[model samples]
Target: MQHFAQYDGEWQNRAELSCLLDILAISSRMDLRNEITKEIERLTKTLVVFLQNPNVDRNKLEQTIEQLNQLNLTLMSSSGRVDQVLGQVDLLKCLAQRNSIPGGSCDFDLPAYHFWLNKPLAERLQYTQSWTADLTPIKQSISLLLQFIRSSASPNTVIAKSGFYQQSLDSSQPAQLLRVSLERNAAYFAEISGGKHRFSIRFMLPADTERPSQTEQNVHFSLHICQL
Candidate 1:
């Protein structure tokens, strides 16, 4: 499931960026410099390879590459201005530590954070907005990539006999991800897994909080083998 894993990773990164943007909105400051820089570097490297692929839309890829290069230049300036801005606000690290404790972040746990929270909402939003501006390019690129990958496949209605289904994959067109859409109120969730040669899906009931058990009844769902 190498292709699936790669697509999953991009999705996860996009989720992380979204979470950061949300947190930044309410807080005056947070040390997300390291995180942003790391992501920028990773995205830059990936985009380089993505741009080389002739199969992808050249116009869109060029636009993304332009945005990435511009952002990279700004962040990598020798003056180190962005680094300094990030160094002053490490509140997120402190808050994360407190959140990991038995109880959530409380005044006694993160007094400094509490102080920041008391600031005017407008001021906090402005500061966070400035910081998150650096991430806009990466976010945009990931969104485009995900949209392209998803649109590459058409969903097929399939039935899982006795809660199980398997299909042999065509090596010529390897899938990037297996998207399974079940009924909104279905009693069970689909557990999908497979490799380059074949794939399988099994509907399982949420037996307990820890693990789900396979269902005995047959299941029906729509499957999309995304390949881009």
Candidate 2:
């Protein structure tokens, strides 16, 4: 079996094989562990409330919560998409069984799963949307979450093991942008010739940041683990 890399530990030590383990060494390169932890905590609480709420529709609640846990942010960027699809199948089966879906089959169809094997992630999302009717909010929310998951590349875009955002670097001579996708194993990294740079770091700023002066390079920007 292929080993998947993941965020592990309190600070998210990045260890391969245990894709879910926190990455320890990268914490110092950028203050990633410090910043993200809070948001993760917040999301955890939100998930708890969402699941525990007495009034929320149970089916919708379960579906949304399932994706939050099922769509592992770190798994994208690798060829382990099978697991994600399997997770979906499992989710669907559980939902079918619970709702007493008329034709639900728990034995699992190997050929049908194989049919889904080659579908592109984006196409898979579209297929899911088309397969379900649009009347209920539970279906709509779960479908939307699926869209979010597919929008993120399963293998992240970032090629390097870690990312850093340093705004103070001289704009004239620039290094490459390091990009990491939350969707998958796709990660991008930067290589610099020589220099210790002091960076003014910001974490998960609102999308409406001031645009760079026209003179600034219209280069791509990525949020490094340290910076975000």
TM-score (all chains, Cα) for each model: 0.62, 0.19
Candidate 2 TM-score to native:
0.19
Colliding pairs, model 1: 31-89
RMSD of each: 9.7, 19.5
Name the lDDT of candidate 1.
0.64
Evaluated at residue 134, the lDDT of candidate 1 is 52
- Candidate 1 lDDT, tens digit per residue, 161-214? 989999999998788778999889999998888999999998998965678888
Residue 7 of model 2, lDDT score: 23
- The numbered model that scores best in lDDT is 1
Q: Report how far residue 202 has shifted in candidate 1, in Å.
A: 0.8
Off-target runs (Cα >4 Å) in candidate 1 are: 1-18, 21-88, 208-211
